[model samples]
Target: MDVVLASSPVDGDVGCWDLQTGAEQMRYRSCASAPHGLASVAGRFLASSQVGNSSSGSILYWSWHKPQVEIKSFPVEPIVSLVSDPDGSFLLGGGSSGNIYIWEIGSGKLLRKWQGHYLAVSCLLFLDNSLIASGSDDGCVRVWNLVSIFGERDNERMKDPFLFSFQEHALRITDIVSGFGSSNSILISSSEDRTCKVWSLSKGKQIRLITFPCIINAIALDPGEDVFYAGGRDGKIYLAALNATCPSNGKFDEYIITCLNEHSKAVTCLEITKDGLSLVSGSDDGTVRVWDIKSQRVIRVLKLRDGPVSNILLVQLPNSTSNLERVAKLPSLDKNLDPTGTLTAIRISPLNGPPDFGYCSSRLMLNAIKELKQRSSVGAMEMELDRLREEQRVCAQLLQRRKKLFDDLWRARIDTLLDDDQ
Candidate 1:
């Protein structure tokens, strides 16, 4: 099921709704989330970074059907952004102190930590399974290759740690979104400078600088990469041309193909549905609006009625996720980085490869266990256990006999040595 989630800084609940039916789901409560800090952890659970004034901030996790937080971890520094890879094996937290921390989600072990930006990290996006793009308050957007960062040896020297760094925006970054390509995808970043810059990952250069009428707080790319929707502080969502070229008229108004003017306040976040037919946006007006892409009209409006919506996410949850299943199989997030700890989580391959992650394999194992429980009886299981114990006893007896034989052979050799010496 495809669901859209909205979070607010002042609100205690994270609002969730069905994208297809526009029906409200279970509202995950007690979450005052930071902007760009809400994420669906590979459909297993929901996680959000809390808005806190303290030096240390916390990240909370809630089961899909639960309203209360099930797990919480305080990081070394306040994290402003949180994201997980599609495989759900690794969770990345961008700290307020410009450091990015990667944790193994299965074991909750901190795998790596490095300074990713000059200022507070604003947003983190996965370009592919192996590449991640981070935007910061320093107005710099950098792409990091996870293969080199995580897989490379400490003694080995990387030619350049960052794959690409685009420092075109003059103000703090508010949001970052990527287009359909893997490593060669086009990255779009919205900033407080009233501009949205598009960078080419393959080319490693700024391709387009779009000047908006207002500071674009959020951006959502069209599935085809033909155009991108930019939500401005002026309460308008501007559809800017991506493939089509407009004659370089110096006016910023020329870049806008059309605009959605229903939002009464600054649009805080934007997300396009999986089918690319609907555009969902959250705003300061405490409403989440879903717009039909073809008609460019609001089809559904979900009233949050709490505070300004800070983040929005659209994710596909598995149908098998039972509401009755309370405890999540995943581990809790670790409070601090453990250098001596080992990451027992099964590592995943690149996005293009076949499935080998723990979550995917775990589902299969769970299904097998359910099937076994249904087919086997208690008496049959006990009989099987007794048979296994008998086999173990036989092996133990054989080992003892072999040890006695070896000891006897050694004594015979020692006696022969004594006779030869006499």
Candidate 2:
């Protein structure tokens, strides 16, 4: 399978690398400023936006197959985030100005601009063909109706405002994601307040809140939709289950079971393949690691020459079905079935494609287990710290009340003494 890693250089250019061959596929120098947002459509085209420079902010669309000429340039504000529709017909760009612009991919025409947010729109996600959800720095998530925007063929303008606005986060929403699991639509948002919240999109109410130790940069959900992965600024990756129901007392337990601690820097982006067999993680350390989800180990580490990897994507090639079938028939090693010295299918072939690096290190597994224990201990300590902070706040409020009460009593006593003197 071919994987693509797109990185926004700290200096200037945007670098795209091929993961399989560890080669520099292409570099685009269109963004005079640093590119903060990147999105791909139809697995053959990409759109990138500059972080700042409102007047000069532009989105560059380029073809991945050719990688030579630019497809089109759409002028918009410095885009903080971008997301393409599932069908790749429409591309949505959101900027720090709290405005969302929709563009037609094939025609390169601006369809409509969504305006209503009072602050910057931090994140955007296309829920379905007729609906879109946006989270903003104003601490509210607004669900927009795409049907109303494009209903009139003569005038393709957004006539109606946001359908519903829900206030959940007390801080800016960093990322918003939606998943369909168990016949339910679950929307999750990570924020700068060190908390991740899950909302029911249909009901427009929050169901659960997952708090973390540090600021969450990004979140990824498994294809099975049973688990969610969150990357924090503390250089830690957390895995939490979504099957746990909310509690009656309006409190639920969100625990992190597994942590990937190989990277020394923050994990910027994460993506899971369509089959959900593998996961790819990009870090500020300028390295991308492909992980085996079942084995819980790193399969391959692709190091980049310059700049940290801002995003990592797993694109299935055209001939993936045949390749997958060939790989599946290689061998099977079932020791339990061959206990009586029976020959197994794996024994027939002494050599395979490449050595399984995931299983080669028992020491790494031991260290990971050890670190997991340490993190659990640290998490307990963090909880204790939170308890102490809450207590301190309560104590301060009590102290202020007591001081007021004492002053009142003292004033009353003084008034009595003045009356006696009179």
Candidate 3:
């Protein structure tokens, strides 16, 4: 079953509903989620970055079965945008101080952190598994390589981790979404400047500029990438053509095909279903509307007593057994970046080589993996062979242990037979 999640900045709970049946699910509690802060962590559980009442910012984790918060993490700085990688190996947070932090999922250890924008980051997106794109309140969109982010780098590279920076947006970027591709993906960003710009990642330049009738707060690209849906502050969802050719008449209607105008207030967020048959949008009027994309009509409406919806996530629900197991195994997010423990020296180089002391084991392993990527093919192959040999030796030792246990059992059976004969 597919689930649609919506949250408001003023509300304390994150509302969830079955996308197909329109039945309300367990509402995750105590989350004043910021815009672009709600996420499904590997589809295991729900996580949201809170706009707390206190000065400090916190992240809350919720189990699928329970409504209350299961875990909470307070970061050093208030994080406005949060996202997990495709694999859920790492959780990334864009801080209010313009810093971006990455934390290892299992260990809950902060791996690497750097300031990417001059102003606060408004949105964070993983273009793919390796590349992450961050849009800031300063009207800049920057892309960073995950491998290079964790690897050992010189001062120049460390100071600026972004591979490409696009500063064409005249105002703060409200939302960003990437189209389907690996290195050649297209990114569409909506800004407060009343426009949405399409950028090509491979070419590192803007490919199309689309002017909107109002300030667009959210953007969702069509599955075919032929068009995109932009939610505007004027309570309208405009359908803009992406690859469709149109005359450059310098008019807003030239690029816009149609619009859904049922929203009573400003549209806050928009998400298209995986099959591209339905478009789900949340609005400031505290209602979630489901639209049939083909018919361009409202099919379902969900009401929330809370304030305006700020975030929306569409995800598949897991089976009961798996959901229970996941909830039981979910780790508590650590508030501290560095856990209090004895320091362990780790080797980032070859096996049994000199230790690269003064770092956490998880981070050291990441650095080692990065080093392997930088090494020559032959050296990396040799290391792989050595690792396989070690695994083989361990398997042989386990076999011997099993054989010894069988031999002991046989001898005991023989003694019992001899005693019975006497």
Per-residue lDDT of model 2, residues 243-301, tens digit only: 76433333324455566777779887777777788777778887777778898788778
Ranking by TM-score: 1, 3, 2
Total backbone clashes of candidate 1, pairs 3 or more residues apart or in separate chains: 0
Clashes of each: 0, 0, 0
The runs of at least 3 residues in candidate 1 whose Cα sits more than 4 Å from the true structure, single-residue gaps closed, are 152-160, 247-251, 322-329, 340-342, 347-422
Model 2 spans with C-alpha error above 4 angstroms = 9-36, 52-55, 72-76, 152-160, 181-184, 245-253, 317-422
On a 0 to 1 TM-score scale, where does candidate 1 land against the true structure?
Answer: 0.79
Number of clashes in model 2?
A: 0
| Alpha-carbon RMSD to native, per candidate | 16.8, 24.8, 18.5
Best by lDDT: 1
The TM-scores of all predictions, comma-separated, are 0.79, 0.66, 0.79
Clashes of 3: 0
Best by TM-score: 1
- Candidate 3 has which clashing residue pairs, if any? none
Name model 3 segments beyond 4 Å from true.
Answer: 153-157, 246-253, 323-331, 334-422
